[model samples]
Target: MKDQIRSLQRLLAALSSRERAALLAARPAVLQQPRPRTLHQLAARLLGTASLSRSALNLGEQQFLEAAVAAADHARGPGLPFVCGRRDLEQLLGVGRGVTADRFAEVLRSLTALTLAWPDGDRVWLHPDATVLFPTALGRSAHGRPPLPAAAPLVVAAPTPEFRPATGDGHGSGAAALHFLDKVLGAFTEPWPALKQGGLSVRDVRRLARILHCPEQESRLWLHLAVTLDLVTERHGRWICTERVPGWLRTPPADRLAYLAVALADVQILPGLPTQDPKLLNQSFATTGPSTHYNAATLRLSANYSAATLRRTVLDVLAELPAGQAADDGPALAAAVHYRAPHLFGPYDPTKPPVPPRPDPYGHWPKPNVAEVTAAVLRETELLALTDRGTLTDLGRAFRRDPGDHAALRAAAEAALPLQEKATILADHTVLVPGTPSPALAELLRDACDLEFRDVRTETHRITPGSVRAYFDQRPGTDPQQLLDALSTRSTTPLPQTVTYLVRDTAARHGHITVAKAGTVLDVRDPVLATELVHHRDLAHLMLRQAGPTVLLSPLQQGPVLEALRAAGYAPNSELKPSAARAADRSEAMYELPQLLLPPPRRRRGPGVAAPGEWLADLSVDEHEPVGELARFIYNRAPSLGANDCNVLATALGAGTTVHVEYRTPARTHASVTVRGPRLDHADRLTSAAGRTPLPLSLSGLQLVLAVPDGRGRPVRGK
Candidate 1:
């Protein structure tokens, strides 16, 4: 047991000062004891019970340590300097049954790197105090379970509802990305109103859900992504499309999906926000700060892994599974991830037997644990088209290999996307786009119609009088014939009469009730329509006064009056073109928080005491003053140790090399001595060849010099 600590001390002593500092940085508790000036002190601090207990060893590493202790206990001969051979331990742990050679080797490397276990050539010298954390075979054998063999295997069969490869209309993430962008373009055609504080209210979310033709949750995800990518931003407390939208439209489809995937993965919860809100996932970036209605306790434990790490880990797990096989669902994926890395996602009580995680709650997997988080990210991957029908696509494979390789992601995304751009105009006032629509076709449809429903591979647009009137109001005096023509150009079938009549009638009625300056008067050509506005719910707050049968008085500004009428589903035209104002709104510069560049590292001041090199360089040695070669060597060397550093000294001691030392006299300031065949009495002290005098060596100072030997086993005289 004493030898184990001694061996560890020698190994630690072998490290350079920088290496020692780094080790301490990695394990802070190792430095909590009185500042260690010697290797023995550092080793003792590292091997202390507090440090050992807090090591946070992973499952595989813990198992390996337990097996090593068990193996050492059963050793037949020569166990004083206890060391466990790699192969012997592997066999005892049934490596092939549960652990792979690469995995085992990696575990060993980690153990050695932490200094928890020292590498002794082909064997490992376990820290004598490590057993305080691991149970011996005798302890385990009493419970009818020895700790020698490995535990659960890394890969497990995914539970049933068998893995099925996605097969559908040749549509995937690329198609989905295009569809999402198209909806964003249409939804932001008008600036969305913002409440006094907080994100879209439930009513607002439902409205957006109606416009995007998806569930509230899915709609929120889209809005979140749009905000994160800077395609949409708040202006005057209302969300509107940024100037980047045009540039975004010009970006290639695949590149757009890649950009979205990257942004989605990078979304992080703002600090000081309630993470327990299930809606936090949706509004992590949608609003300034998010608050939710769900109880925090209803939410599962905080995620053990970050979104990016969890995403990458999920990708890796899928990549490792057999071709055409997936983890069935998020729980299966979670199980696989936990098996691969138990250190993350842990409730691992050594006192309790290991068991599977409980099934998640019934609805809204609020802020979830590892399993729930995995499931959520999996859905995102599906939306990104990285995974299809529970299997990785070409894009998924490429992304898994190199997420930063934008070129590859684009190419893979291009291949997976469906290219059909034509829509079939039905007689029932609906247009059905069979596959992903081109930007031109999508824009045309959104201009003349409302998105009724959308899916992975299809979209249905419904043309109505209200939609046409709204379009004409945005672009007054723009012939409704032009929009109809554009829609006709993109459609496979001719326009239906219902759509044609709806557009022409809506266009003719769009410009009635023109507002004058400050909207003080309303001149309406239709008395009944003007009368209807006074009773309309959306515009009732306007409080219009009937000055005459066809004229109404308003107290609001021109812009507010027009917005209120439009909100009431009336397309009231402005007296002015308003094109410049609309253009300015569209041209509102994208507001982005400037990225602060890190300042350059400051140059450290030189120590008060000059370094050894500067001191040695300044020394005025007299060349003709009869200084011996050994004395000259000491004069030229650094003030501390030279080439014979701790590593070299450790190697020489391990190889049992004969030595002759040229060292400075301890009692005399300007004197030196040369002794042949001196030996290390202990780790830091040397014994004279006569075995009587002991000299303590200061590793940090130039105290000892070794005699260089020739190939023929004799000391070589220095020139």
Candidate 2:
């Protein structure tokens, strides 16, 4: 009894109120069968007791019996209704009593916290006895549906939990940690406060741990690694990632080569920005400014070689010289350096000192052969200099300044009578071999000679052969017979000729085209014809007629026809084509021979009359029209005919009467026939091959000659 009550009290204290009620409701068969025959019996059976009591069982003993009864009752119906609950529940089961609601509530709260649920509402109902136990408010309502049995609370089967090996903090084995850090650093491009935070909080650590599936401590270690690598900087309580880390990590090797090429070319590297040039750290190398030479070399290497080869070339070039020597090498070394580190050489300042010279691994240094190249450079430089220098010498400078003739010989040649005419005039003057003057002295001799005879005005020259002869006769100590000999000596034709020397030197100044105008008439200096025109009356008359009354004869020979015209007495003023004579005695006279000699009056067509087909007929005496009119006139005069149809035949002859035709046979050979037609109707059928369908024919398509027949029966193809 007291023992039972004490046991129940302990059980109630252990369990939640809801759990207790659930246990009491599931009455076992032992509780229901029969109270043991005596107190000793009940005690022994229920509590394994050896003594009996009259008072109620202790709380412990009471709970033991209640649990036993509930188990038995559950056997009759089902097991416990809830897995966990309170003490008063046993009182309602008839096994024990005197439990409080607060205590019961505490039990139920524990059961609920453990996530147990009630099966039924408010009370626990027994199966066979139909006994019901009302629960305290904490155990009254169902919390949720009862959980499945397989998902019921598990007992700790093994004494000790299974051993899990400790993961070492990320000091030595931190590949995953390092990778995580890399990712974190990779995300940031600029300095940010989060990264610089001193240590991770629970949330931060848990987040990193969840991502990595590792311990929080390990995540903290990875972050520390990032700070050490200089990938990120710690400031205040956050991490600030440096910009260079991402650049170094993300840029690929191939992109580096492309960057180098652009840098060498002095072109922009990044979008919308120029590359920066850094001064070389070394001073041993000879420094030359940006050399187009190096730039070109870099371009060629980049284009022709693979990236690896180019990289090797660059490294090799860098290796060949002393550490401080690259500064002196200038753009050459900078170009090589550019191949390896493009981002480092943004603006490519040529004035900067060069990078240290790295030694060549292969011991083979490349030196450009520059002698010929330098020569080419020098040549271009000189040409540019000369262009800037302008022309040399006074005459050349004058030509450069004003660009007129600056050479004595050229000026002399231009001043002379044109060389061709000069030679002719010189020959006529008997100053040189008649036609064999030398080209070298020809111009000079022409300039030396001047016309000796002038008429009263002293402006016009007679230029007669007699005047020339007279001038020669008057020469001091020279006979007329010897004049020719002296003239030959002066001309270029005679070697070592004294007179020739004087002529060559002096004529250069005076040779010019001779112009003579007399009484509204102009004449050219003609040494050949001057004497003939002046001395012969017949020749003068011929000249007037042939050259018109405004005669200007070149003093050269006139052809024989002029002489004949002079003999006929046709003077310069005679009318060439005469007009008709006036009527005699005020009456028209028609004489056939006289009329034949006179031009007929022009005739025009009256209204409605056909226009003249002949162009010559339409002409006003000598006027001309298009040549087509002649062709039309010729086609009108001849008529010939043959056709399968009379309609076509009639069409071939217009009222005026002539037609010409050209036809092609079935064999494709051409043939001609003349046709007379009045209109063009049905001509297509006439021209069609003997058995073929008719095709339209145009007169324009034929090649034909037509003419009217003359009285002699000859084809009058033309008048």
After superposition, the stretches of candidate 2 with alpha carbons farther than 4 Å from their true spots are 1-501, 504-648, 651-656, 670-672, 676-719
lDDT for each residue of candidate 2 in 1-719, tens digit (9 for 90 to 100): 22232232233345443543454342232132212222222211222211122112222222222332343333333433322222334344332233444444443333222212111233322211111221111122234423222111111111111122222111111122223544556444444334221333335544655765545434433444444345565456454677667564443322222222222222111011111122421212211111211111111112222223322333333234332232222344444444333322233444664342222587322222122112222222111111111111121122223223324312322211112222222333333222212344332333334434311111111123444433433443333334334444443454334434333433333324433332212242453443444445654533332143334443322223232335656333222222221222123322225445667988764324222222112212111221243223323321111111122223333333433434333443344454433233354233322222234344433322233344454433310
Cα RMSD (angstroms) for every candidate in the order listed: 18.0, 52.5
Model 2 residue 59 lDDT score = 25
Error of 1 at 673 (Å): 33
Question: Candidate 1: lDDT over CA atoms?
Answer: 0.58
Where does candidate 1 have its weakest 10-residue lDDT segment? Answer: 617-626
Encode model 1's per-residue lDDT on 516-625: one tens digit a residue. 44345788888897788776777766778777788888766555676667776778777656885465434542335799999999976532443333322332211222
Residue 391 C-alpha lDDT in model 2: 13
Q: Number of clashes in every candidate structure?
A: 2, 95
Distance from true location, Cα of 178 in model 2, Å: 92
